[model samples]
Target: MSFVVAVDGPSGSGKSSTARGVADRLGFAYLDTGAMYRAVTWALLQRGVDTADAAAVAATVGEVRIDSGTDPLAPTIAADGIDVAGPIRSDEVVRHVSPVSAVPQVRTRLVDLQRRVIVGTDAPGIVVEGRDIGTVVATDAPLKVFLVADPQARAERRAAEEGGSDTAATAASLQRRDRIDSTRAASPLAKADDAVEIDSTHLSLDEVIGRIVSLVEERR
Candidate 1:
């Protein structure tokens, strides 16, 4: 039986860590849907596609081939057989991902690919994390979690992860991403009605992971 655990949250909300932790504890494969978008964004930028032009992005979508690894401990993303795992996470790609991902066609193509990845998994199940996994990609998932944190807390966490990057700048960037992701036309970031909401503003990573693990166990 496929026991999918869908995790959704805004940037810096600990979606990736908590989801990976849960998948590791349960021995399920992990999928970071956001990386798929980042990979496509990286490819578009590499090809000099104008990210602001939705039509141009949509037209170029098929030209990029994105493949993601499902291991929670070593999740990977490659574009067209090139190991772009490092390049896709650059600040430039981060800035352009929102615009490229906002394109309806891009979302459609990626969503379908995401589903295929989950279905092809041979593990007990999969834990999929993204802004819209619960709301759009896996609405029928047996377990869904929506993680949130105080904006300040999220900013601090993200800054620390980025090698003590500017807290103020990171906070502003995260809030900006939240606005764009939440307002986008295609598969906007949202919490599913059936999902359990976890405010990690004060909770440690283990605490958040534990809470979701209990939920998964109960649902299973």
Candidate 2:
């Protein structure tokens, strides 16, 4: 039986890390759906499309081709055939990604692609991490996890990852993003009713990974 694990969380909640670790431990494919959205945002900026103009941003969906690598050890993302794993992490993309992802048309396109990736993978299964994985992308996933941390902890983690960024600003930005993402019309960030929610504020990355791995084992 294919064991699908859907992990959903906001920024800095350790979704990417935990999902990758779980996938690696279980020898499953890892799909980072957020990277796909970031690729689209990066593509929009590269093409000079007005992000605020929802119509304009949606119009570029056909022109942008996002390719995501699901390897747990070396996940990669590309936008329009250009390597964008690094560029999409820029502050500029961070500031605009929520708006770009909120476009209903963009979500429709990427969600379809994400579903395809999950269905087409040859691995035993896949660990898919995203804001709406449990809620939208993989509602039928056998193992669903929703991770959360306090705002301060999330900010500190994000700052650490960004190489000494300002924690206060990062916290504010995270809050703004949470509001935008939670309230968006299309596939808004949400925890699935059946998802197991984990508060990771005080947990180590390995601990979180272990917990999810254990859950997968029990399900198996």
Best by lDDT: 1
lDDT of 1: 0.93
RMSD of each: 0.7, 0.8
lDDT of 2 by residue, 130-171 (tens): 998888888889999999999999999999999989999999
Give the RMSD in angstroms, all C-alphas superposed, for model 1: 0.7
Worst 10 residues of 2 by lDDT: 1-10
TM-score of each: 0.98, 0.98
Residue 44 error for model 2, in Å?
0.9
Query: Model 1 misses residue 177 by how many Å?
Result: 0.5
Clashes of 2: 0
Give a tens-digit lDDT track for model 1, residues 91-117: 999999999999999999999999999
TM-score of 1: 0.98
Report lDDT per candidate: 0.93, 0.92
